[model samples]
Target: MAVHLSEPDRLLPVPGVRLCAVAAGIRYKDRNDLVLMELAPGSECAAVFTRNAFCAAPVHVARDHLAREAPRYLLINAGNANAGTGQPGMHAALACCAAVAEVGHTRPERVLPFSTGVIGEPLPVERITDVLPAAIQGLNPQGWMAAMRAIMTTDTVGKGISEQVALSGGTVTLTGIAKGSGMVHPDMATMLAYVASDARVESGLLQAMLGRCADQSFNVITVDGDTSTNDACVLAATGASGVAVESTEDRDAFEAALLRVCRYLAQAIVRDGEGATKFVTVRVTGARDAREARVVGMTVAQSPLVKTALFASDPNWGRILAAVGRAGLPELDVDAVTIHLGDVRIVVDGGRAPEYTEQAGQRVMDQAEIMMTIDLGGRGHDQAEVYTCDFSYDYVRINAEYRS
Candidate 1:
């Protein structure tokens, strides 16, 4: 079950974006497994892909296409990752892109392809190509929800958000969708996500804004400590609103709204993590730098012992303490460190607090959401937070029988 997460009641559409989904028998037969998103002419796009050395073939194709021209369409399909197939996989991805380009009346370089699902399998190129004409004909501005659902694999609930930010000239709309349950970790970006806005922003500025937003959002989340081979996040600005984000105030407002949308989607992924019962937040403060804080937080968040303890509703402070100690911070002072579970201080001066009790800790652990704070006792003023989930019996079962 998803932890305090639900499908979006409504998704406001961006004016210059049109989307639709078609039933492509690529992997799933009964539902739409392919989605197409069309951007208005002259739209600017920024994307960040998985950094894994063995990334999916679509990742390579998408990167090359985005570099060559302004994207006109984004083709996405679920249930086949198209990774590890080497040259054959690349050929298949290109073939699908070419088909979309031919049908959409655009150059092949104007189409970016993205895929996610079981790795090491050939993408059913014909299955996706056969639906290209249907997908294009069905494109509508209000197809955000359908597009969100079509890109899902193991995700139990659809994740999406819409926000309208008022600028000096006018208001701009931002809508985003994401999909992932497990194999989520920060490597440039965690999962498959797409955010679109009608505001006017250049590609260079949009890329910089996305990088910052991603650092504070997707780059701070982890699930099972595994990054997907097909992880990709895209931010598109259609310039349909005619409100330029050139002024300093306008730029700040746009980026802030973008960050909020990104953060919400990132947390939703953790809340809907596979078999997750608790949404856990690990905050590391007082570190030498922001990077150090994030490293320490992820160390604790990815610890199996700590995650299992969370699943069992066990307040195992020692497990958290051990993970932090091994985080390899330079010249760390154990005696100066402090830790807390919610508002209950569990560790003081690097040991169990005198006022702490098992009952108080258990009370916090029993909740569906938890916050763990570790104060590194450093003089520097840097902090970072990582979002994760507890590991349960179903997590193992889901992955063990995933292929079956």
Candidate 2:
């Protein structure tokens, strides 16, 4: 039910990466639900995971494995989020890694596991292990799109992107895939994002760059204001193109390319949010600091009244004003606040604009895409933007029967 999104036209694969997807029949019947990705040896990896106190077992294992060594394989399964199972869940996830390592002929410490879908249910380990050989046998260098689809749980469309740019040494390729819809909010990362590049980047630099990129991209989007227990974003550098990013210019180019892929994937998640009909962007400017600006934007974006008003095209600017006022800004001056809905200034100097009319506001809200800006009129260059989707009736319906 996304407003303006469809299956990607094409998703080119990155060098030094091979992937395959299979129907493990873990929870879904006759559908591809498991994905396995193999990375070239010596590829550097960096990742950020959810801050949820009750994170899944795979997240725990993946964190530990990533710390121990460079990962060789990424194993993901949909339809059963191995969460809330305590010690048994951890063991089950480890078993999955063992199976993947045994079949791929690699050390178990080098395999990372990920899971999504229904929570609190035991993972069907045997079903997943039984199909490991088939998945490995079907590995293809051009399996990016298939893997994208296989990781989807509530996502309506598979999301992916591929881009190339000429750096100092040569042309580097960046390819990324993401899956998310519902239970999305920014803490560390929004949902599952895996982006790989064909450039040589040192381990420390890769980790720092991925963290900064994620803060600007995945960490700024929200849907339903619910942070999932399995959110993660990973970046891998294969060093396959022989393009070692060693200079400031090369780093800038590589960072720009990575940002493009991350932004595309992050926005796609909002566009395809559960039962979403309209995409909304909230911009806050003139704040004292970036954190405050983001707090204001997210507060407005997460307001249920604001989202429902957007869905109905009601042009109820009061809900937006109320949310901003309650953003916990201790130094905010009400007299200096201004609000705009897609250039239609609704509030001026903390009150309704004299030139504003109901018809004008209604026209702006009727569009499928909207931009709402809040200016605090402070003497600072700080600003932030948060992407979200309008809440709709079908959102309730989807969750009401999610497991049925």
Q: Please tell me which predicted candidate would have the highest lDDT against the true structure.
A: 1
Model 2 scores a TM of 0.98
Positional deviation of residue 56's Cα in model 2 after best superposition, in angstroms: 0.4
State TM-scores per candidate.
0.99, 0.98
Counting clashing residue pairs in each candidate, in order, gives: 0, 0
Error of 1 at 144 (Å): 0.3
What is the overall TM-score of model 1 with all chains considered together? 0.99
lDDT (Cα) of model 2: 0.91
lDDT of 1 at 19: 100
Clashing pairs in 1: none
Residue 66 shift from truth in candidate 1, angstroms: 0.8
Q: lDDT scores for all predictions?
A: 0.93, 0.91
What's model 2's lDDT at 313?
93
Candidate 1's error at 181, in angstroms?
0.7
Least accurate stretch of 10 residues (summed lDDT) in model 2?
184-193
Worst 10 residues of 1 by lDDT: 182-191
Q: Whole-model lDDT, candidate 1? A: 0.93
